[model samples]
Target: MTRVAVIARILPVLAILVWSLQGVSRAENALTLDLSDYELTFEEDFDRLDVSAWGPGTRWIAHTPWNGDFGDAAFADPRPGFPFTVKDGVLAIEARKDEGGKWASGLLASVDGAGRGFSQRYGYFEMRAKFPKGEGTWPAFWLIGLDRLTHTSEVDVVEHYGHFPGRYTASVHVWDRKTASKSSSVHHRVLVAPGSLYDDYNTFGAKIDADWIIFYFNRQEVWRQSTPEHHKQPMYLLVDLGVGAGWPTENTPDPSVMLVDYVKVWARED
Candidate 1:
């Protein structure tokens, strides 16, 4: 077992009181999540980047298991404080231009090439983070369903593009292998005042159940959708500071840093 798995097994479970929503309207009535009914399944506090190119014991891999690296900046391999670094219990995924002027950044996935690592079928996943601001910075925390042999299912917990400082996006997608098309997809925009996200840390979360996929920002419901059929399989985690999600990178800060305080997951009790 990986060190993270061992740590989770030994840690004590704690109760957390999150939001409670009564209806579809977030403002109508507030509700609370009785976290006592759940068990902590995964936790990464970024004491250090416990990552590798491909791993047998590490908690993260430097690239996607399928090698599908997106965005304008390349997801470079883990090195000494270039694309990724840890200090004061926080992880900084950096997007920067090298001496040669080529853009490179960092991405970390919970699974490796062989599909070996952490994954869950249904759970609550969350990340506390502060994003970098500029014209081309693209920071995101997302999940990919593991049944890659047939089709692809994705849930974008939060995708923040720096050009649009006033809002961010979330999406759920299902792609068909046979038709080579996205058979189902939906997107939502969560609005905030400009420069707010870059100024402080905020929590992004998703609750995945058999029937629904609910999104939360700072512990409050922001958006939700019916669980896609393709998303019934297990899903894994990924976080990255990418440059240019179809946006211009010329004005992107020379060294943009996305700080993550923690990434965690909790499985429901039966």
Candidate 2:
């Protein structure tokens, strides 16, 4: 064979090899939730409605005038099952409009409502959840002051506004002199290309400490920033399914559910 023929054949094979390697590199970069080196403090798998764990009883309290704020939906107690349910090994929060044309949803807090649950100072917190597919459906996994922040310190693990498909945000807010303003606030929207987060369960996490706060999606580090000063105290966890947080709700579906596979908290033993 002439040198030109040999070169052409080899070039095509080399190009194919390069493309395959690039694809592999991209896959390797995606981090799946891997538990390692942290001592678990709490976990809820939703195998059943463990009322002793966190439904309408001692483990967690349903929303009341105290712990319910944000978005256009009102959080209702899960007694009549308007917004929350544990079925088929998953905890689901449904967002819908009532007969009065008002929106109602679910919001669960660890240390508020009628009964106080648990709180931790600094640790690793995570939730494995699948978002609902509907415009204006807002879901959040977050932490706030246990009793009161004194100032206001909030850690937003994952806030997904369903209208912005394939993206979710994380943020930290340290209050200024008042709750309306912030001393230091950091936020970012993690963009996942070619896939929808609502299509499957993905883990969102936050590792909190005295110095810095790290946010993760699917167990991969996505964003980080300096820790807030007033956040030195403990915080309680919360999850909510909200609607129309200033997002367009004209076309929002009548019913949508955010499925939570599990939620966990971990700490360092030492």
Candidate 3:
């Protein structure tokens, strides 16, 4: 009986030691970034379609070479064909081909004469959306800085085309004026679940801190870039659906929809 008791006590000690070792192993391999510690600094209430909420640095402009209303304002076309609409509390940016044999639709950015509308220096930006799918359709949710503010710091958080179904691309472009050469800039690609984006709404986000930038798809880390040089500035958010771009080859024939659920921004609550 005494031996039995000794064995039981030693067994517990051995089990605890094993648990401790497992915890250390996980801590070494696990990569974590918790944004819950931050507070909401800005948000857009799409209830009434207010462009003023976007602030002074943004100017709403139609996509170049194509004249179509892109904002959620009264100036937008009342009957803009299929797939693009503001119904059920969502902004649907659809890509459709007109009678002119060209994909005529969507929005772009224009802050001022120099094209410096909405932009920031450094923070956490995110959007919840579902991309459109079809051969020749190009959909994107990303950000571009003003020429005066960033010089050439374009952060593409999520850009994908139906032609390349199921694979999303993310890149960071720093112009030659900003960096010694274009090749010196950092870029990375991530493989997303096949048909996951257009299947439903997923959260696409990017965290730009003082040292590194991390990209996330549906709360999962996909890519990271360690560019301490360009991490100190803020950037704005842009969500649009484009078509006939060089990547998609302009082969899509039917109208497709890019639905955006919401956009939210956060910063460390100091």
Top of the candidates by TM-score = 1
Q: How many residue pairs clash (N, CA or C atoms closer than 3 angstroms) in each of the candidate models, in the order given?
A: 5, 0, 11
Select the stronger candidate by lDDT from 1 and 3.
1
Q: Superposing every Cα of model 1 onto the true structure, what RMSD results? A: 10.2
After superposition, the stretches of candidate 3 with alpha carbons farther than 4 Å from their true spots are 1-33, 51-84, 108-118, 147-150, 177-185, 228-231, 248-250
- Tens-place lDDT digits, model 3, residues 97-184: 5576555545443343344455566677888888876776666766655442334455778777567675766766554333222312
Please provide, for model 1 over 1-270, each residue's C-alpha lDDT reduced to its tens digit, 9 standing for 90 to 100: 111122234334321212223222331133434468899999999887799877768999988888866777888988887788899999999988888998999999999988899999989999999999899988999999989777778888988889889888777776554553334557777777678789999988899988999888787777878898889889999998888776788899989999999999999988
Query: What is the clash count of model 1?
Result: 5
Q: Candidate 2, residues 1-270: lDDT per residue as tens digits?
A: 001122234333211111111121121255454457679998888885433223444666656315434677777767656677888889988988899988888877776543367788888999999988878888899888654525556788988777778677777765432322224556676777534677788888998889978778778877766776777778788888888777788788888888999989998777
List TM-score per model, in order. 0.87, 0.81, 0.71
Model 2 RMSD to the real structure? Answer: 15.2
Per-residue error (Å), model 3, residue 174: 0.2
